[model samples]
Target: MSHKDTIAAIATPPGNGGVGIVRISGGQLESVARGLLGRDLPQPRIAQYSSFIDAHNNTIDTGLALYFPAPHSFTGENILELQAHGGAVILGLLLERALQLGCRQARAGEFSERAFLNGKLDLVQAEAIADLISSSSARGARAAQRSLSGVFSARVNALVAEITSIRVFVEAAIDFPEEEIDFLADSDIQQRLQQVIDDIETLIVEAHQGRLLRDGIELAIVGRPNAGKSSLLNALAGDELAIVTDIPGTTRDVVRQQILIDGLPVFVADTAGLRESEDVIEAEGVRRALQIQEKADLVLLVLDASTETPENLPVIPDPKRTIIVWNKQDLVAGEMPLAITKGLDSVIISIHNTSGLDVLKQKIRQHAGLNEASEGVFSARARHLDALHRSEKLCRHGLAQLQDFSAPELLAEDLRQAQQVLAEITGQFSSDDLLGEIFSSFCIGK
Candidate 1:
């Protein structure tokens, strides 16, 4: 797992600041450090002020040089960190000197990738490092930190162990065809299998919640012209993000705003009113609105409470994913029509007065699957969810095969496949292409 050549990069962001760091990792750290510092390297894990010397023995800069010997560094290799002035030119000069000293520029996410290869971190933890750096909210950063601390990996590993134990039992049964039926029928075996399946299902749900924290949710606002869609967007965002006009079709395109609800990111899109229009631009807006609704996690169907419910309200593809919003409630003198309000999932509010906005926000949070208890949830990605789902499906299929009592070998194979699928979540069974694709998306110097 050791790298023969050294890799170096400016770990700090590409900007001038009080300080910047140039990080190096590889087997040749001592040699490279000697070449750059023109002196004995600092003691292991100790920072020492030193003059950075270049090829011609000219002093390039003066900074703190800290060295960490192999097996105890971030990448499990000899690591050297140069803390220097934050000037971009200074960092570039230091990087160039390192490259001249036999180290090359580190690729994007290479440091974390090396950590994964060296067993310093698992795939999930490696990804969590990137997630933690990119998190947009405090809650999200905390969740990613939990994942980096192995909260998510521990759960996955526990599930993997359960699968391994069950697979061992199933495979043992398969070896003795005559006793296989009885073995599968054992109450303990059936219970263990069901328990594992249930645990996988639970993990899937929690991972989904974690994914929402990491990736956020998309809420599409859709309604007839002048139904306060723009007003609702403005209210949720706490700013006038969209133009509100009494004129129909004022908004002829999609306007998006990112707002946080209870520390969870929500991307709200205010689209043109869903209505039949002769104007080409207006028609296109309606088309885009409908398209966004089809893909949105939740759709806010805004209805003007001051006016009678429009008979031609846009069809909600999934009622469960749609929130009926009755806006302009302040203009209504009496109670809302029972026919429109009763037996329907709806929230009434006034955008001008901000009435019932809290309830709407709460609803959005509820729909996004976030709560006060989410503090402990670990961040997850769509790929992790996909792997979990595949594992769950395979586990269920294996259980069904056991129930049929005709194909013990098939059940054993199913369990084996399920175990492998779950293993991919932690990089124990991942393809190189998947690893490449995942790391390539990370920012350079991560």
Candidate 2:
């Protein structure tokens, strides 16, 4: 895990700030530090005010230099950090001076990658660092922090241990057939297998919630012309984001607005009114609206309560995924229409007066599967969800084989495959390409 060459980069964000940092990590940090500081390295883990000198022995910048000796640094190598005034020119000069001292620029996520390679962090923890940095919501950030603290990893490891114990027992029974233990027929073995399946199922549900937190749900608004589609977008966004007019087909393109519904991020897309139009642009807009509707996690079907009914509306491809919103309640006289209020998934609201908006927000949160209980969940990526799903499927298949056909060998193989799939989450069985892909997405100097 030891690197031969030194790597350096401007650790802080690019811009003017109160202070900036140039970090270097590798075996040659001692020489790098001495060359830049123009003096002997400071005591390990202590910050010393020093002058950053160039190769010509001219002072490039005055900064605080902190040194961390080998085996005690973030990358598990000798590390040096130079904190200088937050000026682009000064930071560039410091970085250039370090490069002159035989240090190369670090790539995107190289610091975290080195940490993972040196056994300082597991795959989940390393990825959690990136997730924490890129999180858009406060709840998402907290969830990522929990994952970084090893809450998620500990759970995965416990499951791995349980599966490993079962595999060992099954393999032993296969190897020692004359023991007369009847391992396959034992009720204890069956119970253990069932418990493992149950655990996997539970984890899958939690992971799905975590993934939703990490990547918020997409909601598409669709309906015929002048059905308050644009009005609803502006109302949800709490501003005039989309143009509203009495004329139909005013919005010829999709208008997107990202809003937080009860701490849960909801990407709301207001699409063009669905209708047959002779105008070329409107027809294209209608086509794009349909495309967005198909890909959305949920579709809000806006209806003009003043006139339109469910029977006259366009057929929804999936009624379960569609929420019927009765808009213009202010224009309607007397009680709400039976067609709009009859359905459990329907909500009556007036975009002009902002009535029933709270109920609509709650419905959005409910449909997104996020609630107060999700506060304790950890952040997870789509890839992690995919792995968990595969592992769970394998475990269920193994359980079925053992229970119905009494095929111990097939069951053992299924368990092994499940174990391997789960191992990928923690990098125990991850491929090199997968590692590269994961780290490549991280920001530089992470």
Query: In terms of lDDT, which candidate is strongest?
Result: 1
- The digit string of per-residue lDDT tens for model 2 on 1-446 reads 23577889898999999999999998887688778987888889888999999889999888899998878888887889999998889999999888888888888888988888888888999999998998888888888999999888888898889999999998888788898769766888888878987887887778777777788999999999999999999999999999999999999889998898866779999999999999999999999999999999999989888888666676664777888898999998886675543654889899889899999988888888776586678988888889888988998898889889988898899999999999899888889899999998988877
lDDT of each: 0.88, 0.87
Q: Whole-model lDDT, candidate 1?
A: 0.88
List candidate 2 segments past 4 Å from native. Answer: 340-344
Once fitted onto the true fold, the runs of candidate 1 whose alpha carbons sit more than 4 angstroms away are 177-181, 310-312
Q: Per-residue lDDT tens digits of candidate 1, residues 1-446?
A: 23566899999999899999999999787778788898877999888999988889888889999998889999998899999999899999999999988888988888898889899999999999998999988888999999999999999999999889987877877776676446754878778889988998899888988899889999999988999999899999989889999998989889999999887889999999988889999999999999999999999999888885546556755888889898888888998753664566789898889899999999988887786587679999999999999988998888888888656788889888998998999999999899888888877777
Residue 203 displacement (Å), model 2: 1.3
Model number with the top TM-score: 2
Scored against the true structure, residue 60 in model 2 reaches a CA lDDT of: 85
How many steric overlaps are in each model, in order?
A: 0, 0
